[model samples]
Each structure stands twice: as C-alpha cells, then as structure tokens.
Target chain A: MKRKQVLVRIFSLLVMLSMLAACTPAAAPTAAPAAEQPAAAEPFEIAVVVKITGIPWFNVVETGVDRAAKELGVNAYQTGPAQADPAQQVKIVEDLIAKGVDAIAVVPNDAKALEPAFQKAKEKGIIVITHESPDQVGTDYDFELIDNVKFGQHAWDQLVKHMGDTGEYAIFVGGLTVPLHNFWADTGIEYAKTKYPNLKLVTERIPCGEDQELARQKTLELIKAYPDLKGIVGFGSLGPIGAAQALKEKGLTDKIAVVGTVIPSQAAPYLKEGSMKEGLLWNPADAGYGMVWLAKYLLEGNKITDGMEIPGMGKATLDGTLVKLDLIMDINAENAESLGF
Target chain B: MKTLLRRHEAYVLLIIIVVSIIITAVNPSFFSLENLFDLLKSMSLMGVFAIGMLFVLISGGIDLSFTAIATVSGYAVALALLRYGDSLNIFVIFLLAGAIGILLGAFNAAIIYFFRIPSIITTIATSNVFYGILTVLSEGKWLYGFPTWFGDFANIRLFTLYSPAGNPYGLSIVTVIWLALVLLAWFILRYTVLGRSIYAMGGSPSSAERAGFNLLRLNLFVYAFIGLMAGFGSVIQALLVQTVAPNSLVGKEMDVIAAVVLGGASLAGGTGSIMGTVLGVALITLLGNGLTLMHVPSQWYDVVIGLVILVSVGVSAYRMRKNIQRRVITETA
Candidate 1:
C-alpha cells in the first residue's frame, strides 16, 4: 500500500515538473532579463499583439519578436487571444494597461473595436505601436510590411501569368471586415480591371481565408456554382492552400490556378502538385521584429524620417504615422522549402 | 411514420428542407449532387462531436473541454506521426486519440464529481488549463507532413458519384465514421440499461441514487465518452484539413451546443435523443453551407448563428414548460 502511494506521488511530481518546463520558455525570456537588470536601467516591456495566436502566421511573428527582444536587450514579449476576438483583445490590453507596460504593439483582429482600448492605453501613457492595421486611432505609429495596394496588384500579376490574363476568377479575403485584406481585394480588383479588361470576377469576395475548412467548403461550392472559374486570388494565409486542396480533390489542379499569402511549408506540397500557382508574403517575423524596434525608436523620443533603413525591415517610407517597408516574398515550388515558416 | 411527426427533431429536419428549397431557388446549383456530397463531408466534424456533447447536455450538464481535448489529442497524434507513423494503422491512431481524450475527460469528471460544482464552470476552467498547457508545449507551432499513407484515409470513400458535368464526388470516410458513431450512440441510448440510468440521474441526482443508480459510474461514462468523441474528432479534423492547427477548434464550441439544444435536447436534463442531435447539427451545417453557396454576405454569418442559438435556447425553455404541464396532467389523471 505504501509503495502504491509512493508511485502515485512520484507520477504527480513528474507531471508538475513537465508543466514547469512547459511554462519556462514563455517566462524565461522575461524573467532572465529582470534578474540581470541591476547595472542597467529597467528594460522596456513591449508586447506585440497579433490578430490570433498559434496559427503559422503569428507563430512566425512570435519568433521575430523574440529575436528583436534578445538583440535589443528589452523586456519584450508577444501575446494575443487564442482566437481572433476583439473583446478578448480589449481585455488583454486592459490587463496590460493595468500592469503598466512601457509600450503596447497590436495587429488588430478588429481595428475599430480596439479604438477604446488603445485610447485607454494612450491615456495611461503607454506607447502604442501597430502593424497591418493602417489608419487606426490611438497608436503612436503603424508599420506596414508592404504597400497594401501593391501587394494586391502583385498577387493579380501572378494570377495573370498563370491564367493568361483572362477568364472568370474569384477573390477571397481573410474576413469581409479584415481591413488590410479588404484593401488588398479592392486594390487588386481595381488593378485587374484596368490592366486585364477581359478578366472577370465571377463572384463577390469570399471570407474563407481564415479557416481552412470553411475555405475548402466555399471553394467546393464555388466549383459547383461556377465550373468555369479559371483563377482565384486569396488574401489570407490559409486561403490559397484551402482552394488548392479543393481543386486537387476534384482533379482540377491543372484547370484552376490559385494564388495568395501562405506559409511556405503548407503551400509547398500544393505548389509542387500544381494546384496553387504562387504565394506572395512578407516574413511575419520581420514585421514582429520591426514593430518592436520601431516602438523603442519612438519611446526614445526620436523623430522619424522618410527612406530610413530599419533593421529587420528594409528601407522605409513615411506616410504620416504609418511606416511603409518593401520586403515582399514570392514563394514558388522550388524555393518554398527554403523560405522557412 | 405517423408517430415520427411528434418528434422534435422532425421539425428541425423540416426547417432544413424548407431552407434548402429557398436557397436552391436563388442559386440553381445549390441542389446539385456534388454540393450535397461536399456538405456530407463538411458537416461530419461538428455532427460527430456534438453527439458527445449531447450525452452531457442530456445528463443535465455541459462539457466545454471537448474542443481543447480535440486540439491536444490531434497535436499529440501529429507529433507521434511525425516521429513514427508509417507502422501505425489509422485505427491505432484513433485509439491513441481516444485514450488521451478519456484521460482529460476523466479529469473534468473527477472535479465535478468530487466537488459537486456546476459542470459548466468546471469544464470551462479545465478547458483553459488544457489549452494553455497545449499552447506552451506546442509553442503555437502547427505540425504538418505525416507519412504519405496518412493522407490516404481522407480519400477513402464508400462510393463515387459523377455529377451532370461529369465531375466526380464521394461521401468521405469522415462521414462514414460519423454515421457509425451515430448508430452506436443510438443503440446505447435506445436499448441499454446504462442509458435509462443516465436519464434518471439527469432528472434528479438524489432520486437516481436512492433508486440504486451509480452516479460515479454514470458521470465517468458520459464525460469519458465526450472526451472519446473529441479524440476521434481531432483525427477526423486533421484528415479533412490535412493540417493540425492548435487554436482552430476551441472557440467553435457554441455551434455544437446550439445544434444539440435546437434538435430538442433539454438543458434541464432527463431527455435527449441521438436522432434529435443529428438533425440539430444538420440544421446548423445547412445554414453555414447553404449561405456560402447562395453568396450571402459573410458578415451576416455570425448574426444567423447567434439567432439559431437564441431560438434553440427558447425552444428548450418552452419544452421544459410543456414537460411540466404533461407531468401535472398525469398526476391529476
């Protein structure tokens, strides 16, 4: 009986140890910096909030945030709600404000919903930085990975190459209300209308890029509804992969070409299989790294100038509280494996 | 056939049929054979997992941890497959997932049974713990690229059908598994002694104990089964999407809960049917899939889902009243 009790106790001890080990990664980066900060002034507590956590896009962003934190010797960390919900984000920001972080960087799930939270953060004298959310209120500055309009036009250019600049094509965004995605859709459609007059948008913009299953279902429905759909430009990271999978399932890989922003590894198989023609993206890690660096730069009371070469990001152009950088990545079958997630 | 009309699930089915007709009128291709088969594949995940939730709801409790269980089990299996998957059969993978699910479900059950706290609050707390631990361990990374054979299960089909345009489609293996689970749950609830005891316990825990029912065993059974369902669901989701994303499944709990309640399951317990749960899931899936096919604006999606959940809760409340009134009539007679 004593031995059985001992065994059970040992089992629980092991479980507790593993949980501690699991938490160490998230806590270690912040904890170690604090312990060593006696000789130096207090490090900045910068938190870069993304739209959602645990997806490939933001996971990559977290890595970049870590890299910048280590390089700059700042108490920088990244967090967001598990899923993209504005209310959860507001709650997270409220907690951060309550804790009195030095700066709060956000990639909004819903920009307008976050206005009140950002305003609260600003009132608390917290430095506010944002990425992928342009024209958002209550931010000191918004940094963009690429020109949204140009990014859209680039996707259309790739689609035009594969699809011969003509036929009934469709557009898809991360969500109908996702600001950057809609901007891309609008600019891409406009560019296509002027350049490729024969090309047609067969349907209204679909909001399927955020969830793979929804994207797959919508793509299947699209096929059944419009069998002649020759090209598709998807705006979200998961969109093209979903479209590619659907086309592959129906043995229409050669018939329909898909292009969008996708994690390379996820798109590699689809790219090799010929279902997805191209995936255009900027390294999200770079965006995360750049957001942190920019926040530090502003907090140090530095005035920004146009055409400044920012580390982790390239040469930048200023657009009145928005930092625009050019670092677009064109991922194809051959190089998809090399462009790490 | 005549008595079937009295079933609450029958009305949900009728609603689905009516909705289908309306959608088909606007988009002629909405009624196509290919779309139906695609939907059969699409709705399989929610339909299968909601059955697990159905038992809990019927037992006068709720379990919100199923999605977290699914995510963890799915991630675990994905990691396992990455290490040594070529030798493992698909069924063995399912077993691994279910075992993991059962352990977690037992965790939720143990808390609720020992503390006697409301199952909703307990499950909700446990779900956060489960998902938080998962995020830390996974470091929020999505694992892909199992052995080539791993992809084969998703392609397995009972039969292939060609649409009018000569495009081939099939009812997926995921749908087949869901149907099999449906039958198993129906048989248990319809014919087994354990099933009746569950109903009794849900009606009144004290009354059930006095009548010699084992509350511990029943609690263990229902919670473990929900976890088991989550385990199978994780594998099914990976098969369909061909990727395992940790955060994708957890926030989708409301749709399943809404569907089961809509299908005629009373939250107050003492009643629920596998048939009703299935019809409820169908109604939810039809709205999502049909709206997409008909090209309704995407922002309207959430509003419709919210309305379904609201209407279902209303139905459950009204049914409780009707149930009480019938009991009074019986007592007087």
Candidate 2:
C-alpha cells in the first residue's frame, strides 16, 4: 500500500507537469487558414464555456449557437463541466486561453473565480462574452449577453403584476452563493423597497440549493414560518414548482400567488393547476444563438459599432463588443402550455 | 441451510427487512416498487466502488485517491473531445480513460511499495495532488456532449431486472459492467494464491514476509487494482449519467467506505467479502431514498446516512464479538 501511494504521488506529479505543458502556448491555432477564406475575412475561434454539459437546458442553447455559427460559417465550440462548479469554470477559461480560442462566451459559475481568467483571456486578445448568468461580466468576462439588472427588474415587475401592487411576499431562490440568483433577489428587494413600499418581504430568504426536493422542503418550512405570506417569487427552475407544491399541499394555493423566472414547461402543471400564477424566462436557445452570432460577427472584422445587426440574429446593439438581447419572458398559464420542457 | 441463515449475510438481510418494514409504515412510498428499484440502482454504483475498496481494507490497505483518479478520468475524456476537436474518435476517449486509470493505479502501487508510506497518509496526499491537477486542467468547467453512445448504452434493458429511474431505470450497461468486475474481483479474492497471500499479509505483514511472500509486488498489485477500479468507477459514473461534474461525487469516498463497513467488512485487515459490500451498498441506498420520499429534508439525508453507518457497524462489531467469545469458550473447554 505504501508503495502504491508513492507511485501515485510521483505519477500524479508527472501528470500535473504534462497538464501545465498542454495548458498554454497551444491555446490558439498556430495558423487558422487565413487564406482559405476571402482576403477580407479574418478567421477566428470562439469558445462557449458553460457551467456544465450533457443536460437539455444548456445543450439546447448550444444547439441554437451552432445553428447561428453554421449559418454564419464561423468557427465556435461549446464546453463546460459535467456538474456545476465555479472553481472548475475558472480553470476552463485558462485552458481556453491556452487553446487560443479567439473569443470566449461563458455562463460564469462564479463571479470572482473567473475574474483572473477572463482578464487573461482579454489580455490574449480574446473577446469575452457572457450569457444568462453574467455574474463575472464587466470583470472576468468582457460583457454579459443578458441584462441581469433588467432581468431582476423584470422578475419584480412580473411578481407585482401577478400579486397586484400590495401584498406580503417571500422569495424562493437558488443557492445564496449563485451570483445571478443573489443579484435577482437583491434587485427584487430593492424594487419592493423603492417602488411598492407597502409590500412586505417575509423574514429571511429561502435558499433551495438548486434542488427541487430541498426547494419544496424550504417552501413548506416557509409556509409554516409565515402563513400570511401572500406571494412567492422563485428565482430558479425548481423553486417555483417546489413552492407551488408546498402551497397546494398546505391549501394556500389560491391565497398566495407564486411568480418568478422558471422554465415554462416545468412550471406548466403548477400554472394550469392554478398552483402558481405565472413564471418568466429568457429563451436560452435564442440567447445561445445570439452569442454565437455576436462572436462570428466580431471575428469577421465586421466592425464593433453600436446597433449593428448580425444575420440570423435580430438587430443587436453592441456596447463595445458586448451585445445585449432584449428580454423575452414566458408567462405560465397563459403561455406555458405550448412551451417545451 | 440453517448455518447459512445464521451467517452474517443472513443477519444483515433480516435487519434490512425488519428496519424497512418500520420505515415503510411511516412512509408507504418507501416500499413502492419504483422506489425500491431506484434505490437499488442508485446504490449499485456506490456498491461497486465499496466492493473494490473492500479488497483494500481486508488487506489492511486504503485508497483515498480513488475519488481523485475517477475525477481525472472523467475530466480527461470530456476535455479530450473538446480540445482535440474531431481529431480523436469517441471510442478512443474510453480507451484513453481506462489506460489513464491503469497508469494511475500502477503509480499508486509503485509509490506505496517503494516509499513505505502509510496507505492512508499516502493516498490522502495523492488524492489532493490528483484533484488539484484535475482542477487546474478543467478550470472548473464540466465536460458534456459525449457521443450518444454513452447514454444509449446505459439505457439498454436486460430482462425484468432493469428500470429507468435513477439506478432502477434500466439494466444500465455500466451497472452490468461493474457487477461483472465485482464478481471477478470476488473470485480473485477467494480462489487465487496471490489473493490468499494478500489476506495473509493483511493478517500479519511481518509473518507473511518471513514466510517468503513478496510483500512489495503484492502491495503494488493491490494498490494498482484499487486504482484501476477507481478509474473504472469514474467511467461508469460518467457513462451512467453521461456527464462528469468535477465535483460530481465530492466527498463521496465516505459513502463508499460506509457501505464497505456496513457490509460487515472489518477495518482491520483480512475480514471482508465482496458479497458483504453489496449488501452494505443496498442498505445505504435504501435508507437514503426511503428518507427522501418520507419528506425528510435533503440536507438531513447525509446525517441519516451517518447514523445508519454507525448503527450497522455497531451491530457487526457485536456479532463479531459474540463469535470470538464462542470460539474462545470452545477452545478453553
């Protein structure tokens, strides 16, 4: 056993060294066939680094991105961890730099962890764009595709519309550590404080850790904790469904209106059953499509000016190189039945 | 037949039946066919790892680095496809992953044999180093989009034995592969000369050395075997779910160890069986799934798991004590 341990240590060290060797210098294609394309065209590579891969949510988005890429004839690839881990996202960015991908589109797992990697990518002349979770935007990532600030405002707007202006409300969110969810909560609270001063947010926040079961448990606990709560705002896919189930089980379904950003399909039963009022979501597929379009548009020396619309993607206004797609929300009950899961 | 019923395995079976009966009375869904099958399927993966780890324990050795090795294989396969683009075939990815596993196992064996380091200490260090390397290489991103072959193979059915929910969903090719590996491992342990030598060494390394057992070579092979299993475990895990989250089973080594201990495997060398580990895995999975259905909070599941381990280990210890006392009285008389 001792012998085995020593052997592992030495071999792991060697692997580490080899990994470092493969990390940098080879990040970029030494010579992307610049001549193969028209003389005016510049060849480039774009890397879409997701939080993880092999799931329908992110994969469908990647599929849309590939559609945009194929239509535009630009080179792009999607990569991410198999599970959601921020620390791993940081390393992926670094590896992307070593691979010399021309631009990087990241759905940041962590805001801070990828800051250094994003800066490094920028230093290497890589365009860094973010989608959905823009936690690392304007720091590690050059720009965010989604207007998170607007997203937060949109969530509050929907909640207000669902519950009417004056009511006691509570928030069911993903992990507290998830920057986008945290920001959405913060903005939602701020909107409540400034705009609807009469609306009281129930004591404490519900963090479900992104698990449906835990979210349901938290919602049950919250119902017990605050029976007077008239509205619930969920900031994740499972949170709304979990909260709705909790509300229904407690016979408070009609008493409390549930609203938030969730996948329409996942929230359909809750909506149709009248357990929840509605849920909002940006089209992840379109978001991915726009990201690929933006990467290709910029790589072609297409000029980074504001209000330039790339083909296949609707008119996108660029603030420098960051393209922000207008928010598209999916309302449950009214609009969720037809939505794909 | 009566003696077989009196065996530790039968005792465990009785305990499961009795305990689960009580649990089901509280939450009837806990006994549902869907739930039971899911529990078995989910627990089987952990069982496979625990069974492999059982060999190490009976030999008075440990492999903390198994988790790290698994993570590396998972990440490497995913990264290879993305980095190499279409240059490498998907089949090559599995081969590369397996080769890497074997190499890692060999390295573990060689180091422990040559350095005379304690198995626990050495493996812990290697685990950290191995995980660190994987962390740096992956940069915190998961690798996805393996060819459909991965998930498709996992969905294949074999008779009425498979279901498609968690582990219960289908006769997952990965599950079958792991079972085969476990059976082969069991055979090697019970029937082979080298296998018996390992047990002898575990019983008393000094005595085994005096008796001309090649401790270094045996230790090396044993560690390598463990490493190989860890690698295979990761592959199955990746294929089982078709994704390798860098932190997929973070801190899962404890669960595997718990299963082994629960299965009546002694921490002290030379006293465990592959069959015992399987039972242990089933028990742990059933408890977890049953509790979840009972509306027990997900956060509390780990705590329940810990308690189950303690209770099961206590029972095994009590039975072992009685056996030892009986032997002593018989010898004295």
* Best by the TM-score measure: 1
DockQ (C-alpha based) per candidate is 0.23, 0.06
Collision count for each candidate, in order:
0, 44
Among residues 3 or more apart in sequence or in different chains, the pairs in candidate 1 whose N, CA or C atoms overlap within 3 Å are none
Q: Write the per-residue lDDT of candidate 2 for residues A1-341, one digit (tens) a residue.
A: 43344357446544644553343222211212222335566546677887766444575677776776677677666777645667666777788799787888888777677778877877888877776555454542233445667777777887888787887887766665677788888887887788888888864456663555446545644443344667888886667866776566445677778888766665666788888887777777776777777666666666556666555445656554345656557576877867654
The model with the greatest lDDT is 1
What is the TM-score of chain A, computed separately for every candidate?
Answer: 0.88, 0.80
User: Compared with the real two-chain complex, what DockQ does model 1 have?
Assistant: 0.23
Instruction: Write one digit per residue (lDDT tens) for candidate 1, span B1-333.
Output: 123314567677777888899889988888877788788888889987989988998787788789989999999999898898798889889999999999999989989999997787677778778887888778778888777788887888789988776677888888999999999999888799988888888877889999999898899999999999999999999998888988778778877877887887756666788888888888888887777667777678778867866775566456655665776799999
Residues A151-193 of candidate 1: C-alpha lDDT, one tens digit per residue: 9899999999998787988888998768889888888889988
Share of native interface contacts recovered by each model: 0.48, 0.01
